[model samples]
Each structure stands twice: as structure tokens, then as C-alpha cells.
Target: MEKVRFGIIGVGNMGRAHAHSLLNDIKGAELAAVCDSSPERLDWAEEHLPDNVQRFLSPEELFKSGTIDAVLIATPHYDHPPLAIEALGYGLHVLIEKPAGVYTKAVQEMNDAAAKSDRKFGIMYNQRTNPLYQKLRELIKSGELGEIRRTNWIITNWYRSQSYYDSGGWRATWGGEGGGVLLNQDPHQLDLWQWTTGMMPKRVRAFCHFGKYRNIEVEDDVTAYVEYENGATGLFITTTGEAPGTNRFEITGDNGKIVIEDGKLTFFRLRTPEPQFNAEYTGGFGSPECWKCEIPVAPGDGDQHKGIMRNFTNAILHDEPLLAPGEEGIHGLTLSNAMYLSAWTDNWVDLPIDSELFHEKLMVQVQNSTFQKTPVSQKALDVSGTH
Candidate 1:
């Protein structure tokens, strides 16, 4: 195929952005069709999208319409896996949005389906295109930062107002969103955490505050601790409560340490690797010699969502590798799931968590929910400055 014909099934905030991207910025992608369950969203598409674009009120219609070669599923967190699964079944390449699914059980099933299909399957982990993160991954993977000892990420700038949650019925409720902050806002960071480091935690223990600042029924604040198989430790702290929040990621290894914050990357390079320094040094009150350097990052961010889309298109048309493979999405979702399970069970959760147990616990939250949501609008909000 010269160009990948794309159909977007959910013109919500992110979906609308994807529609615009596929329509204009992405070169090898053509916006073949658009679908949404919301009438207001369909109206917006009618006004904003080209007349040549096929519009559908239901995703199933668009999937089988034979107008699209690929489908981008941008519905709620819960619908991502099922919609992608169905799209794959219809012999269309599938691209899923973040969180993959609220639960790993469903996402695993979707991954299984993708494995059996001969079509291209990818996830919208747009941040993977950022050059800053790509550089970090290179450093770690190249062994420049030898043997990671500790990692900490404080990505808590996702402050959502009451009006934001009040705008959609499926904003923060467990029945609607499955979980908050971790599920909705922090998936990218969680994905980046494992993606950049190339390691998954051996176990995780987390403390989550449900409805701590929001009026919703799901968690809005969380602090999680994880230990890697090599005894490397990590701390992930995030929330949607604080206004003047911070986003800083620091990693320490045997060679030195690196900090990424405020759009700048800094490195403290040790004259010698810490293990060697400790082994060779005879002094009691000394540390390895360190040289601070401001590592230069490439100017401007990557095409982000557009970049991921273009990469997916290239993968389908030219045999290029995917930047964010759909199956790998499970790693980040695993971290998020471990956090929720640790909090819900009041105990530590291990890697490759018991999906059945997590699903059982999640069902209780869904079945026992009594919170009534009041949606303030059915129209899509301007998602320009937000993730």
C-alpha cells in the first residue's frame, strides 16, 4: 500500500487530535474514516473534518466498511483492548491508545489476538518518540550508566480540576475509568520508566490515596516502591491533585548518575565506576571524583503522536520496526496494575501479577460502586496543551 488508510474510532480529546494529525501532519497516513458514539463529537468531526472523510456513529460500521486499512482505537481505557481486538479480527492493522486496558487480563487477550493476526499492531506511546527519552535509553542500553542502582521519577504535574472530571461521566470513577492518575495520567511515565531502564521490578509495594483530592471514587494520589531483580530500587510518585507539581527523573548507576527535568538533561560522571572506586579507595571519608555536565539534547521534541503514527504506517508499508509495539504495552500496564493491586490488597505485589486476582478485585469495585457522576458536557475539550 502506498498510504495507510486510517479510521479513528472515538473522536474524544486524544482521538480528535489523532484525526487532525492523520488528516494533515502525517505524510503516509490518510484519514479514511472517523467514528464516535457521542453526537456532539460527530458534529465536531462534521465541522472540522473534510467532507471526503467517511463518518460513522458506530465503530463496527467503520471497521467493516472496507474504507480503512488500519484502525486507531481511542476510546476509553476499558475499550482500547476490545476495540483493537475487534479491529484486528476485521483484518485491519490496529493502533491502541494508552493504558492498553484497565486490567492486564483483557490486554493479554488482546495481545494474544494480535499475535495470531498477520497485521501490524502498535500502541500510541507517543512519548517514545521524544529524543530526550531516546537518548536516556541509549545511555543505559549502551552500558554508559553501568548497573543501575536506583531510579526515581516524580511526575506529578497532571493537575485536573473538578470541572474537568465533571465534564465526562467516565472521568475518574472506577466503574468509568477503572483507576485514576496511574491509569489515566501516568501510563506514559510508567511506560517510560521500564522502557528507558530496560528492566521490570521484581516486586512492588504502593500506597494509593483514593479520592484524596478529587470528588471521584478512584485513586488520585500514589507512591510506589519497586525492587529490581539485581537489587536496584525505584520510586514512582505521582498525583493529579497538586497544582505546582514537578516532573523529575533521576537514575544512579555504578558509573554515575543522570537527571532529566525542566527539559534539560544533566549528568554527573564519575571518574571511575562506583564499584571499582569503592573497591580501590582506602579512604573512609571520600567518594568517587565527579564531573558535572549538561548533556545537549536535540532541539524540539519529535512529532510525538504523529511520529508514532508515521512509524506505524512505515511498519505496515515498508517493513519498518514499530517504536511502540502493541504487545510491549503490557510491561507498563503491569507496573500500574502492581501498584493498584498492592494498594487494594494492603500487601506487596510481585511481577507477573495474578491477573485473575486483580480482575476479581476490580470487579468488586465495579459491582459495589454507588457514586453517581454528573457529566457537564458531551463536547470534546481542547486537548492542545495537555497530554
Candidate 2:
């Protein structure tokens, strides 16, 4: 194919943003079709999008149209897996948004489908393209930081107002969004937590405050403790209630420690390996010598979402490697699901979580939810700044 033709399955805020990028920013990609269940959203796309771009009221219609080589699934939390699986079954390249799906069972089924297909599969983990995180992953993988001992990430900068939640009924409800903060606003961070360290926790204990800050029924604040197989420990703290919040990720290893915050990376290097120093040092009270250094990072944000899309297109056309493979998305979702399960059971949940139990508990919330959501209306929204 000279250029990969693309179809978007949702025309919501994020979906519309992806459509604009495919139309204007990305090369080697064409916005061939767009789909949305809302007639109002379809009308808005018709007015704002190019006249030649085809439009459909349902994803099944677009998938059967056979006009595009790939599809981007940007619908709600529940629809990602089923839509991607259907597209892959049709022999089309598939790119999914974050949090793969509401639960691991559905995502696993989608991954199995993708594995059986010969088409390209990718995920919109755009943060992986950021040079800052890329550099962190490189250092850890290179053994420059030695064996990781601890990791802590305080990412509470996602502040959402009541009006924001009220804008959509599915914004913060369990039946609607499956979970809050972790599922809606912090999937990128959760993904990065495991992606950068190249590790998954063996057990997780979390304390989640449901409707603590927001009036919604889902959790808006959480603090989790994680234990890895190598005896390493981690702390993940996040919320959507704090204003002027903080975003800091720190990791400690045997050789040194690194801190990333306020767009700066700092490394505190030990003059000698802790093990070697402990074995050789004669002094009883002295510690290993340490030097603090501020590591330099490349300028710019690395084109984030657009970069992932461009790579997805190239992977389809030129056999290029994907930055975030669709199947790997399950790792991050596992962490999030473990946290929620821990809170529900008031105990530590192990890795490779019980998929049946999680789904069963989630269905209880969906069945008992009492929140009534307002129907979506056609309104001008600038989603560029939201992400």
C-alpha cells in the first residue's frame, strides 16, 4: 500500500483529536472514515471534517465498508477490546487507546485474536515516546542503576471539576467507566510505572477512597503498596482531587538513585557499589561516597500521540516495529486491576489476578450503580489542552 488508510471508531474528544492529526499532522496516513453512535457527533464531524471523509453511525458499518486498512478504537472503556478484536478478525491493522479494556478477561481475548492475525497491532501509549521516560528505561535496562530496590511515583496532577464529571454520565461511575483516575486519567502513568522499570509487582495492597473527593461513585484518590518478586518494593500515589498537584517518579537501586520531577532528571551516583563497599570498607560509621548529578534530557515532548500514530502507520506500510505493542497493554491494566481488587477485598492481591473474581465484583458495582448520566450534546470543546 502506498499509504495506510485509517478509520476512527469514536468521534469523542480524543477520537476527534486523533482524526485531526491523521488529517493534518501525520504523514503516510489518511483519515478515510469516521464512526460514532451519536447522530449529533456525526453531524459535527461532517461539518468540521473534510468533505471526502466517509462517516458512519456504527462501527460494524465502518468495519464492513472495507475502505480502510487500519482502525483506531477510541470509544468508551468497555468497547475497546470487542471493537479491536472484530477489526483484527477482518484482517485490518488495529490501534487501541489506553487501558486496553475494563478487565483482563476481555483484553486477553483481544490479545489472543491479534496474535492469530497477521495484521499490525499497536497501542496509544504515547508517553513511551517521551525522551525523558525513554532515557529512564534505557538506563534501567542497561544496568546503569544496578538492581532496582524501590520505586515511588506521586502523580496527583489530574484535577477534574464537578462540571467535568457531570458533562458525561460515564465519567466517574463504575458501571460507566469501570474505575476512576486509574482507568480514566492515570492509565499512562500506570503503564509507564511498569514499562520504565521493566518489572511487575508480585503482590499489591491499596487503599482507594471512592467518592472521597468527587461526588462520583468511583475512586478518586488512591495509595498503593507493591512488592516485587526480587524483594523490591514500590509506592504509587495518585488522585483527581488535588489542585496544583505533583508529578514525581523516583527509583532507587544498589548502585545509585534517580529522581524525575518538574521536567528535570537527577541521578545520585554512589562512588562504590553498596555490596562492594560493605565488604571492603574498614570504617564502622562511614558510608559510601555519593555524587549528585542533574542528567540532561532532549528538548521537546517527542510528538506524543502523533508519534505513536505515525509509527503505527509505518509498521503497517514498511514493517516497522511498534513502540507500544497492543498485547503488552495488559501488563499495565493488571496493575490497575490489582489495586482495585486489593481495596475491595481489604487484602493484598497477587499478580496474574483472578480474572473471574474481578469481573464478578465489577458487575456488582454495575448492577447497583444509581447515578443517572446526562445524554451527550453537541458542543464545541477544545480537547487539545485536556491531555
lDDT of 1 at 316: 95
RMSD of 2: 3.0
How much lDDT does each candidate structure score? 0.88, 0.88
The per-prediction CA RMSD against the true structure, in angstroms, equals: 3.1, 3.0
Off by over 4 Å in 2: 371-387
Output the number of the TM-score-best candidate: 2
Any runs in candidate 1 off by more than 4 Å, and if so which? 370-387
Clashing residue pairs, backbone N/CA/C < 3 A, model 2 = none
lDDT of 1 by residue, 1-387 (tens): 899999988787788888889988888889989987667878898999999998887777887799999998887677778788888999999998887988999999999999999999999998999888999999999998999999999988999998888876656877667888998899899999999999999999999999999898889999999999999999999999998999999999999999999988898999899999999999899999999988888977777888999999999999899999999999999999999999999999999999999999998898766543223124222221134
TM-score of each: 0.95, 0.95
The stretch of ten residues in a row with the least summed lDDT in candidate 1 is 376-385
